[model samples]
Target chain A: MMLNLAPNIADPDDFYAELVNSQRNLDEEQALRMNARLILLLANHIGDRTVLTEAIARARAAG
Target chain B: MTNHIYPKFGYLRSKEQADGVVKRHPIVVIGAGPIGLTAALDFAARGQPVVVLDDNDTVSIGSRAVCYAKRPLEIWDRLDCASPMVDRGVSWKVGKVFFHDQLSYQFDLLPESDHQWPAMINLQQYHLEEILVAKCRANPLIDLRWKHRLISLKQPADHATLAVETPDGIFTMEAEWVIACDGANSDTRKMVGAEFTGQFFQDRFLIADVAMKADFPTERWFWFDPPFHPGQSVLLHRQADNIWRIDFQLGWEADPDAERQPERVIPRIRAMLGEDAQFSLEWVSIYQFACRRIDNFRQGRVLFAGDAAHQVSPFGARGANTGVQDIDNLAWKLAMVLRGEAPEALLDSYHEERAYAADDNILNSTRATDFITPKTKVSRYFRDAVLELAQHHGFARPLVNSGRLSVPTPYATSALNTPDEDFAIGEMRPGTNAADAPISVAGKPSWFLHCLGDGFTVVTFGKATDKTGIAIGPLAAKIIRVGRDIEDPSGLLAARYGASPGTTYLFRPDQYVAARWSGFDETKIIEAMLRATGQDSARHPAGQKELAA
Candidate 1:
């Protein structure tokens, strides 16, 4: 059975938007994506290479 | 015996004594916070020498992370002192949201599985630390030193040299590696020139643990635009000692001190409650959270974990959970490299796997925080709209909860992977391949293997096959009889992971599944293990295909 795979739990592209979304000026979606990016960037900084590569793949898997 | 650690010699001392006692360990964990201490416990459980240091005079007495998730409880079980924590903690499964004194929504957190531990437990963070401190104290190998402040740290080829300022004076200690479980403001990370770049919220929130009386429902309650609180909202969580953690989302520009006055805070509560309520404030903290991460977890022999690596808002309880996972990924591997069993590349995977996990945690928490407490005018409007819609539409509630946001991080696909379908999606790959070791030999071990949550076990089957990675450990291999229906020795593993016969699993001194293999392809599986533990898999019992095949 060929099943469609969803993205990995950690997607990096949404990094910046998720971090700053909490700002009263930013939209909720923007803040969420900012929050997501901040998390991804931090992980990238930590050198969790395999998880990072896989996370990138997870992000790309959808659609 | 040659490599075992003695607790009294390991950690939590004044800066001066530690400066004088020159010693080397695979990892020297700084700061015995929940995450830091968990890392030390896992490292010690892996039969490696570890020295843990903390500058705090006592076990955390502050309003740190009080909400314990199910995953962390699993870790505490591995540390061999979960009973006290479970006994003292309160389990809350039912929660509701109230809008202006009317109950709007309710939900249950019990995910179906045949496990005994509740999904979420409420205990003081200090209580959890107290239990962990006892476990760390019991471990002859995990050293716990409190009140020892880290002044300076240098990363060398073989170790990260730490110069700590303790009660006595300055002293130096050498370790094969240094793992920083330091807080968000890590001096070690700063000293190594790693930049923590991200958003710092200008808005401040008031988090108060209080004892109160009111007609409000006794569940996890969230109020959206209550009468008195026109703009702000309240999050009430019942905690130990008849205390409730209340968070008021005071906008970024509001005066912090004004919210503290009994005249200011109590009237607001009374106005919303529709009656007078008596309450005593336990602790009130103003937190302007940061969504930040250090650029890298490692610089030479030094590594970062916990809050030192990444920080997120308190929503969804991911911060400490992700940090605890940091130790989960690194501890056993450090034990292996120090024991001369695996390659240095294995240590590199810790950063790989955990950094990914940390990344996910930060994003999840960030998303949840943004939704729950929006900063912008549109988001605030949209959030109110979402809540209003939720009041009428059942569809919106679950949609909101889906991203309540959390997951255990793993390296399912990477340079370390074999390109399976599961890996294609970045989900946790569950299969018997060349990589996994069985959880038990008596029966088919669990793929998500645990050692009844204690002690170390090496699992393999078929009258014995010598594996490379199993050679260096405090525990021995679990040899299985492939076709035999033994009483489920690892019933919990079966419940958690659903493993069948002819499987191999290697459980660390902590009960977490280190690596699992489908069957006897010795080299490939050992290679993954070796890579994980910072050793060379190319040496003995080599499997060239673990990565390639």
Candidate 2:
């Protein structure tokens, strides 16, 4: 399966703000783990190994 | 409750007090703890006179600050004290982390070989102090004054005078420079009005040093929510003399007094060490730690090092290791400034570099504290998730925070570092501490770090040559030709330093890389030394062609 290249979420700016606000008042470690949990939850929802592997590769390449 | 007996040195009246005259010394170190005594030893190594004052005449009561890292051992080696420590201390490299009786992850601190010292060692603070005190007593350049307490400090325009109360009487003494190594509750810090600020943890940990004859392996074992103590963290480490140091986390609501009693502490130890294990209680104490540092490490003619300047949680074994590095970065600069080889502004870089390292330590300690004692339910859930994954996955292993074992902090953004003229490889950047390797000096077996003198060193990786005219401003740079003067038998030194035939490296007095170039350039080397000594203010922008020109 091919990982989607185009933006998929509606109102991307609002979603980004909400994603950041989810970690409000959290310490650095707490916020990092929260992000880790968020990634795991989203990966479960996607539920595609090939897509997840491609996404991971893309993330690594971007960094 | 401690089984070990404390050694005491009776107070003696100083000749200055007997003469009823105030004497001014070159350096005055307050508090004869490990840091203060080490400072005195460092000054003596440079052939400078130092007077060390302590309120008491004995080593500290409890077995505090047990773990000593490799960097500090190297520093002690320079002062001719590492041999006794390594001989007496228990050294280990591997640490295992468990989550509720299940192994979560394990780590090897020093996977690479060919180093002089081990990754880390565990020896009680009192034992370390006893070793250092003996060294100080042997050195003629050091004066150890026992039972002398500082009453007040007055800093004038020219110098600072300390009024100390001894067994004889209160007397005044002066110093060109004063160092405060008076531990966490520093009276010198309060007297000098140095503002200390940071996070205050609302948790308590019970530290018990137990003497036992068990056959436990000499490795660090940490547990989170184990069966012995549910919903809490426990750390186990081995020290010298058949003693084991155990730290049990008791939440903020636990009573400090009740937790210290043997009746309450024995059951906790029995649950972890098994009920039939015969162990005698050596020492038991309750402590609450904070991750805080002073506003500045230097205040005019007076400076602070060790716990007097910064405080951190004991989780990472950072408390004394970081402090020893502070003194390592400080003493040479102070010597140069005192001898008028460098400008007084050179002292400012001590604050710049050490304060940066202090912040790094505090950040690590704070992160570890937060993970081990999560404040929020969501955070604890994430921590548990990471632990659960760590048992089966490799990626999650990095997320486990069983106190990021103390490592030397690189001054990446220090002003003293000259931008590299050559592309850098490996970890040997401008402000990074020098790494050691196996080498032969003139056909005899020796370590690479043993070749560094107490002055600036210029290492060129080619044949021997007459580099006599090479001098960095007023300071002469000792030239060491690796191929001719020192042979890299296994080529590990050259490989670790990323050196070619003509590669040239300049190291500071403290053995930190100041700058490196692909080829030897006299002008560039001098400029780098000037910049490292805070003599040059011009910034050498990275990747600039002007250096080539």
Tens-digit lDDT string for candidate 1 (B94-114) = 667666656666777765554
Per prediction, the TM-score for chain B is: 0.81, 0.97
DockQ, structure candidate 1: 0.03
- Positional deviation of B409 in candidate 1, in angstroms? 2.9
Alpha-carbon TM-score of each model against the true structure: 0.74, 0.90
- Which docking band does candidate 2 fall into? incorrect
TM-score of chain A of each: 0.38, 0.90
The whole-model lDDT of each prediction reads 0.62, 0.90
Worst lDDT run of 10 residues, candidate 2 chain B, spans B540-549
